[model samples]
Target: MSNPADLGVSSLVLQTAEGGDINPVYLGIFVVYLLLVLAIGAWAYLETDDVNDFWVYGKRLGPWLATWSYVANFVSAVSVIGFIGAVYGDGYSIMTGIIFGLMLGVSGLYFVVHKVRELNHVTFPDIIAELTGTEVARPIAGFVLLANAWVYLIMQLVGAGLLVTVITGVPYEYMIWVIGGVFILYTVLGGLVSVAWTDLVQGTLMVATVAVALVYITLDLGGIVTINQQFAALDSGYVAPLGDGTYTGLAVLASIVAFFGTIFTSQATIIRINATDSIRTAKIHLAAAGVILAVFYTMLIMLGAGTTVALTDAGLTVDNVDMAFPVLITEYVPTTIGTVIIVAILSGILSTTDTRLHACGVTTARDIYDYFTGGEASDEKLMRVSRLSTIGFGIAATAIAVNPPGTIIGLYEWRAVLLTSALLIPVYVALYSRDTPGKAVLLSIILGTAFGPGWEAFGAPFGAPPTFMGVGMALIGLTIGHLVLKGQKETPAETAVGND
Candidate 1:
């Protein structure tokens, strides 16, 4: 699952009149896009020769391919749909969370991320194990990766199923199977090679479609000045810096911490960094993706405000924020462009879903499985295991998606908290503080999960985002472990990532 698009935190539903005829155009676009993606999977099967190719696409990534894959894998309905939905409620404050938090994560990453490339690793666990010099790092980081990927997969599947169900008028239950089955199939057959190339296609279309939607909305509502006036007319705070205080400063700060965790530690990031052909390409691609995301998100402001104005003029009000953009598309936008928006939304979801699902495969075959193998697993044998694991996790995630757990934001939070709380700092430490004891790394992870997600599970007693406490404790654990465990233990040897 790419993202529930948490677009703010709900399934996207485009409301229509009773007995509305299903649009053949949407069905055609959706079907054609899926076939093309599946075909890429088939081709990648040929490109993949061993586990090395399966995991990091043979490290042959260039600037454009990496840039497209990077952005597409990160963007989901949440960015296009959920974010626009967020604008409906919080207004400009939401922009700070997206623009400031994510942009900083990407831009700041440029400084230190090259070292990640230099590591010559495969999955996230590989890096952690290498940097921490501990065997325990693999299983611990592996489990967290699965947890993150599992929840994230369900998030994308639900969003994707809803998209197909609503657009094609397929039952949600049936759409879940169709969408879930196909993503699992492609991911297993192709691995990162297929995933990366498909992301390029998905990413380009995602940007173009949203850009079109934002442009149409802007013109239809007579531009940003007119859109601002319309929203200001709705409420002065809509144009105010804070946007009605739906999300306070504390909330924004917490979100940034959450964003940082995901950026620093997620498998999606590790593979992208390592997959690059050169460190320079990784830097350039990441910088480019950052700028593109900035522009794309800035357009979300217009998509939200402009759509509000357009939909209001049409005498429609969507109580569900997730429905706002979809309603805007079906009712206000031209038919051709509307179909493109629907297709892109689904494509965006799959683009992200495939990336996350691939992470699950890495966690299983590379992370957990490798621990048992002790770095001696044959390349062909490990490749088979990766494929088997991909299929297994895909089926599991799809089954869960058919009956997803919790609300959208709650589900997406699991994806963030586990990795962010546990691995974010450890990842950086491994990069910069290589001398930090293995015990310190392990404790940082343990306390981070305890304070972040463990705290969240207990209802977050402090009434703040879990990242605040989780990361706080993570830092404490790191410092304490360093002071206590330093020189008391001999660090384990660094085992090279075997399949590579």
Candidate 2:
């Protein structure tokens, strides 16, 4: 039997055939990418002179730039490493997964963004505090946001380390330190202004790089028809309908709900929505981001399918799904071109890393420290704390990345479950229905978070998937809590204000 790695690598080699190890060239490209990012960061630092500038870019981002940055922020290490790996394992069902998630996300945004705008909040915790009118919600939401950001930051850091290790023949540990150090500096110094601008550049490069790779892979595999035939031959589950027995109608519905719910609740997603200058810009940017993400994820799914076919034809099976793109780039593309792809991967990883780090800092300072301390903290003090907290979290994430507990896909899934189950319901209520009682919101968050993770740890009564169990319980808990709280009486005047 051919080694899976050999099969994948051999196919890549066959495509390029440009002699010589291209690691040096790849390293050079990576240097250039890093330099470009640094330049953007430096420029942003010059433009930013206050805490608002640091945390929210003074809420001045326009539609196009904000839209691209939003898309880029949403598509991080997971889009390339985790999502593609998912397709490699699950086949065309992955495309359905992407579509279902995207559609719901877009719909959820329409409702959520308007509410977020009304609150005039900068971070996720700000929206939570506005809705609950309780200081507790701010700190809790901040902690959750910080945790989610840290988990995502680790993923991005790991992806960056992996790229550097692969390109420079360096140890993963060293690469982690190097990437972490650079990210901390840029993020602390430049803040959101730097992160957003860099994201714009990196996002464009990432899309272009993926497009080129997809085109090359499609042509190599004799186009879409042949690709579909190959997948069809692999498994009947590859192209089944949403209600098909493979994943079940209920599960599909739950997945869609979870996707929509998560995006609506997610601080990362909402922060981007809040970052836009106006409601009109937010709407336009949200729509544009949805379209861009749909296109990018669709192409990724196609690329994954194509890669699966190519590998199978060569008598290989991928064990490490995250390796799919890297294997292809190194083996199939010309050395010089392959180097560019590597740089693109690095760009994606760095853009995400910096954004998440900045988010962690700002969320911690604003949501936790400033909230509990009676909001008396000066911007300079908050900014200092934010920067320090960012460094602290970066260290923690680097530690986790150095000793990852599971596969990249598994880590991403766990992070998604954690963030979606606990925070999604509360976020949605806060954004859409102002009448949702503070007690209900708090209960929903506690129950959803507890049940979501609990169900994952202990098996469900039936043989339900963990994700379904978590999200289902979260929704049920939120509904019950909301209804229970809704029964409480209020004066006619109070009711009218709540209704609005």
**Candidate 2: stretches off by over 4 Å:** 1-22, 241-246, 315-317, 459-461, 465-500
Clashes per candidate, residues 3 or more apart or on different chains: 11, 3
lDDT of 1 by residue, 222-280 (tens): 88899888888876766766556665678678877787668777788888899899999
Candidate 1 regions exceeding 4 Å error are 1-21, 491-499
**Once model 2 is optimally superposed onto the true structure by TM-score, how far is the C-alpha of residue 38 displaced, in angstroms?**
1.7
Give lDDT for model 1: 0.77
Choose the strongest candidate by TM-score. 1
lDDT (10s digit) by residue, model 2, range 186-291: 7887888888888888888888888887888789889988898887788756656531356666556655655565576666666676777888888888888888
